[model samples]
Target: MSGLPAFRPEALEQWLPRTLQNHYVDLLLRRIGMTRRRADCFVRLALYLFLKNCQSRKELPKPPLTELSFPQGWVECSCLEAADVFYSDRDRGGDRAAGMMLNKLVDLGLIQKQFDGNCTQVKFHAMPDLLKSDAKNLHISFAIDAFDPRSDAIPIANLLANNYNWLNRNNDAVTYRIANILRDWASQYTAGLRVLRRSDNQNPVGFYAFYPTKRESEVKFFEPPSRGLHLSQVADVDPFQMALAGDETCRSLFVRSWVIDSDYRQAAQMELLLDAQQTMKKMQQDFPNLWDMYTLIIHPSYAELSLALGFQKTNADPKMPLYWMYQAVDRFLKLDMQNLMRDAQSLN
Candidate 1:
């Protein structure tokens, strides 16, 4: 095993400059969240899309390429839909075939579904993590709707700074300007999306609002067919128990943070975790098709607290900084309060 943990290609790009052609190659490595040859394929796909301004070579959504368009020299439209592309690659597994190539982008927060019914129109949002702070005001909003179908590419500075704010340090003008130059070079060379932001004050602090994107998969647990089969087998399981069953349908749980007073961070997070487990357990007890519950990663800064609560890490990647963790829903309820209190020492 290598000393350095593996990263997906998309995650790798996050480490490099914000604006650079072939940014996806590095990111692709990060997205797979592992070291593998397929990461190379991700890079090639990025290159192909960069040159053609299309995501796929054959004009087919198959392999669902995101960064580039297709070559003008190509004649046939392939007329093939994403479903066909998925089925054709069924050996890779339907989910992997239809969605694997693009899943990394979603996981990295580079792309998201606009959620139009059935026709499958995916809109990409690029924003920088930049938060401008000053004595008077803080500008913490992204340049929205930057991606256009007709445009050949997005500005590198805009994409990098847009999606990633960790690059921006409070009110440092020099770093921000240098970041712009790097963005320009990336726009000219690479083909990937970014998140953008701009703040008013030169140096500001505390409480900037942000809208981070979430990944959506077509796979949902409550859907027909399998629901009936699984519901009967696990009728009495607790939400935590159901989540551990590990069925495809259980993967659709959506998680988001709720705003509360400053003093409530610890309490609020705990409550939310409990609610999420209860929600999954409810579905498990009431719904037949549901199996395992899907959970989101806790924010990195808060992870130590979650671990103390008995959440086991399911993902490991240095580039991600954040991680997703899980525990049996039923097991969660039986956790000893004393143990939780003892482990809480880490926070002190």
Candidate 2:
């Protein structure tokens, strides 16, 4: 035990998003039908253990095999200690709460676990499959659409509520503000929103919302004040202004909000990216001035995906939680279109 790395509970609490923490709890309760208390404790403790392992991996000089295979890998920890930290009763029904929760998570196909002597090794297996399935479902028709506020409002609102509620935990103020922004964009015909709906029920599973801007003032209309600090740290002058500066011939499309439900996240992300590429093409044709795309990405997973798609972070602040990333539209458009077409064909 002395040779193995120690778990840091504080790091897990600090790095994990409140929205994601709640999401895990909701998933366990809805999927496995666990009681609220048990589900909360189970998810909290399990995620802490998982993140602790991830932190340990980061400290190592070489990457773990699981990291190579999965986007978010797994961790191994002491089941007894995990239970002692999360549950009041160290033993629940003679099996212990940690053991019972681990069993339930394994049964639900959310995690894979193996006993290695006294320690338990666990890994996540859902996100990769979700991503592949989403990519398979991509179609040109669903890539971009004219958003209808009347019919699309409820589902879009629900999606936003689930993903961004942590920003304003006290009420639905964030949801309302976002709804108003979407309505404004739809009404003005200045922007569009792409939604990915479930195949069976047609309920929206994910969405990507964005709008174009030519002036620095326009950036403020899209982003909240809380995000301004990160943007300020990244640029001595206004970053958005700098991107648009001396480019009288082009405009920047600001990616305001993007999210996918936990169950279909990876697939939704692929679909969203595919749709965004198509949308860019359409925007280029309709609005020839559209020359670049920029966004302030807060989530690490989103930042990783954006970087993979050729977005470069502008901010030099090593400590900033958010990233201001951008990509030139015209320079990459031709190659991007070719790749997108190839990807679409492969999916077919």
Candidate 3:
């Protein structure tokens, strides 16, 4: 490692002027979705792992190629060394920042890391390069429409139970149970939205399900319930729990689920957020009583995303790794989502 990049700040600085502008930045924005500055930080670490991993892949049998494949990868390094690669000495504090970035990268599906004694084993999974034909197209690449429970239920059930992408972050078993319960309570969903891939493949890629409720019931979501209404313990809002009929009054929304394919989320989130904003407008137009939205989050990636979108974690449970998150309709509308998401690579 003498002549090559050796996980040092100076070593990485040498290539930044040339490589960071093109290859690294574009991929981080297109594949990982980050602000230029944050992408710059992530790219440095990515380059170090990628190049060093390449040096070690000389004899290993290459795996079959696919969408999110890296031709040469995997490296084991001390947390301190990774810290040096990600942040300069002036800004980084030993291994703490390194650990945070590593967790974020793993959550983003950029790299998979496992702790091994004092060091970490890192495996690079290149984000899919399927956008080559229209590489310059920055528009939302997927389509969205009202989620049809009849056709999308099975797919939603499958995603909730079987998607390796989400299950990896949250436990596989927890989601499997959640999937079944979500299916059983499908009728409880007041509004649902589904995502579709571009071109001819019409299979559903993701969905966002919601439950509208009256203020009396909405209070439990903002406050910690004694029984603790985690996603696993959530129940349907009975007819009495429904908000009173109004010609055009404000009502609250309980987010049942916001599941998007891991592949589609990195690129489509901004557009989807914009779509959601419009959807709220339409919902308010129809319901006239659309108030605020809230939900319990167990998935780490979704938690980070909900945080970035301005969802505040209520005093639900300090001991638990999960809790309820809340956001008002007006607050979401007031947000500059495009700007908020640019630097949200870490949160995403």
Candidate 4:
């Protein structure tokens, strides 16, 4: 039998690009190392609803349009409610096993979750992977104002290869797994990559994974991290974006598998870090409510380089288990009142 009408006639093809539709079908069959058909169906359902309400030329709304109104019959049958309906329709299975499929969809960048007031709403963007077409080399560009030499900002593949080599040699299976997880996770957030070649002799390095510091704040974890020892509270984080922590606490912007050629290691890595830091600060400056800067993770191969650059380890765990470091820039500058207070105290 033909598949049930997944969406209203107007939305079926309009919601997803032809390339994305083909990609989704491929992802369903192979699972991209993690996805499923049911989840794909659910995402399709979300796509239908989102297209029915949202216009795709603009960015997908983080919380979706707050004013959105769902048709009564549509709401009752919506895939946004799929989790509830799917679980109830089937026997209660293991925790999250039901939503495991949804998680995979999120991993693949087909859907995202957002909080609207007290209720949670999911938004679907059927955009294909931003960094498609793996190549032997790539060239990446960064914000002109934010460029630096000592940053963990490079193509994802280079980052992965560096980490994979380091972890494999060290026999750290966990780090390897975490690296894999992060690669997949970053894929969802990537916007686009444009290759900019430096030299014909040198192969293109890799594409930049642009995480717009302004577009990621609503993600649950980006909330101000706890004021733990060694952790500094920052006040300039961009509203739309913050880095992902290797650990669950979200204190560090985990940088995994970052590799550059031996010759350019110092220049390339440092440039990326400095750029990321400056860009982050600029974001924070624009959005005073957000924090300024966070730590990063690199392969142990870069540990010596990081230490030389003043990145200290927060833990002694030999596993080197994604260590956390901290950095902060003073958010408040002395104003007339503070200067007056300082003057009075100094006189006393």
Best by TM-score: 3
Better of 1 and 2 by TM-score: 2
Q: Please provide, for model 1 over 98-188, each residue's C-alpha lDDT reduced to its tens digit, 9 standing for 90 to 100.
A: 4554554444343343334433333333211111112112223212112222231223223323323442234334334424433442343
- Show where candidate 3 strays beyond 4 Å: 1-9, 12-17, 30-33, 54-74, 88-93, 126-141, 162-190, 194-199, 223-250, 285-287, 339-348
- List runs of model 1 lying over 4 Å from the truth: 1-261, 266-277, 289-298, 317-319, 336-343, 346-348
lDDT of 4: 0.37
Provide the lDDT at 116 for model 3.
68
Please list the residue runs of candidate 2 whose C-alpha ends up more than 4 Å from where it truly belongs after superposition. Answer: 2-144, 166-172, 216-250, 316-320, 335-348
> What TM-score does prediction 4 earn?
0.31
Instruction: Encode model 3's per-residue lDDT on 1-348: one tens digit a residue.
Output: 334444366755453444433455566665433445455555666556555665576432232212222434457766777667666646535678778777777775667888767667877664435334235334545777766556666666666554333423455355545555555455554343444444346677777756566666656675543333434433443322444335244377777667666656665666677877877776676567676787777566576678778989876665655577778888987889877776675442
Compute the lDDT of residue 214 as modeled in candidate 3.
62
Compared with the true structure, all predictions reach lDDT values of 0.32, 0.54, 0.59, 0.37
Per-residue CA lDDT of model 2 for 133-252, tens digit only, reads: 434554422233556687776778767666543334444254565566567566654344777776666667777766556555445534543454321132233333222223345477
TM of each candidate vs. truth: 0.27, 0.51, 0.72, 0.31
Write the candidate numbers in order of decreasing TM-score: 3, 2, 4, 1
Worst 10 residues of 1 by lDDT: 204-213
